[model samples]
Target: MGLNGQIPRCEHIDRCPVVEHGPPECRACLALGQSWTWLLVCLSCGWVACSDDSRGGHAKAHYQETDHPVVAALEPSSTWRWCYVHRRNV
Candidate 1:
C-alpha cells in the first residue's frame, strides 16, 4: 500500500510539506545522532521530524509559529501515524 493508503486524510494535509516531499529533513537534530524518540508530523505542513528533537519540538515550533496541530511517525520500521490534537494513533 502507498503512504496515502496507510495514513488517513488529515485536515492539515493541504498545508504539510511532507505531502509533497514525502518526508522532512531534520538537519538540526539529525546531526546529533540522537535516535528519534517520536515522529512529529507537521499539522500545518506534514513535515516529519524526529521526536528526539524534543519529540519534534521543532515540528511543534512549526505549530507554535503557525498554529497547526498534527503529526505522524517517521520511524522507518513502524507503520503507525498519529494526530497531535486527538492524541491518538491514526
Candidate 2:
C-alpha cells in the first residue's frame, strides 16, 4: 500500500477483479493454507492471491504470468492498491 488518496482511473480499472469479487477468492489460502499478509486481487481476471510476504508470493507470480498490473489489498478497511507495471502504489 502507498499514500492514501484517490487512485486515478487506469486502463485495468474496468477488468480489475477486486471491484467484482472480494479477497476470499484467494486460491492459495484455500488450497495451501497460505496466510494473507497482504492479500491481493488480480486486476486482470479477479483471481485473489497471497502477497509476496506470504508463503508463496503467488500475487507476484500472477502478475508475471498475466501481466496484470493492479492489485487491491484484501485486509479489512484497507483500500490500498499496487501497480506492478508502474512498480509503485497507484
Candidate 3:
C-alpha cells in the first residue's frame, strides 16, 4: 500500500491505532529469534505479527486463523494497511 490518500477500512477494522504508534517490533520476531523485514498488526486485536517476508509469517497466519482482514504495517513510518481478504490496500 502506498502512503497517500484516505485508507480504506477492512471488514475487521476496529479503532484508530493512531493513538499508539505502530508497535516497536514484531513480537513473533523476537520470540522466534527471527528477523522481520516488515511487521503487521492485527487492527481488531492489536496482535503484533510478522509479514510473509519473515520466516514466521505470523501475521498472515493470524489472519487465516482469526478472519481478521485488517492489518497495518507495524513500522512506525508506514501509514498504510492491507486487507487480506480483498488482497488490496485498505
Candidate 4:
C-alpha cells in the first residue's frame, strides 16, 4: 500500500507466462565468464538473470528487451517481487 488508502496492485502479474525456480547462478553471467551479486527470475517468461547490483544487470535488460513487467528474487527463501513498469516492489 502507498501513503494513500489505496491498495497496491501490479497489472502485469497475471501476464506472467511461467514462474521459474532459479538456478544456482546467473546463467548469463556464467556464459560471459563474469560474476554477479544476485539473481532475479522474470515472472513474465521465467527468464533467470543477474540483478541490477550485479555488473551485468541482466534482469533489467530482460525487462527492457521483452517489456516484461515483473520479476522476483531467485533466492530460495525470498518472496520479493519487483514491477518493472511501476518501478516498485509489488
What order do candidates take by TM-score, descending?
Answer: 4, 3, 2, 1
Candidate 1: which stretches are off by over 4 Å?
1-18, 22-24, 30-35, 52-56
Q: Which digits, one per residue and each the tens of the lDDT, describe model 3 over residues 1-90? A: 335765555544454354343466777679778888777788867888888888889889989998877788876688788888878886
Question: Which scores greater on TM-score, model 1 or model 2?
Answer: 2
Best by lDDT: 4
Query: Model 1 TM-score?
Result: 0.47
TM-score of 3: 0.68
The lDDT values for all models are 0.57, 0.73, 0.75, 0.85
- Stretches of model 2 off by over 4 angstroms after superposition: 1-19, 22-25
Q: After superposition, how far is residue 82 of candidate 3 from its true place, in Å?
A: 0.3
By lDDT, highest first, what's the ranking?
A: 4, 3, 2, 1
Cα error, residue 67 of model 3, in Å, equals: 0.7
- What are the TM-scores, per candidate, against the unseen true structure? 0.47, 0.67, 0.68, 0.82
lDDT of prediction 4: 0.85
Q: What's the lDDT for candidate 1?
A: 0.57
Lowest-sum lDDT 10-residue window in model 1: 13-22
Ranking 1 against 3 by lDDT, winner: 3
Residue 82 CA error for candidate 1 (Å)? 2.3
Residue by residue across 1-90, what tens digits does model 2's lDDT show? 235875555555555653465547568677886566667877667778888888788889999998888887765688787888767775
RMSD of each: 7.1, 5.1, 5.2, 2.4
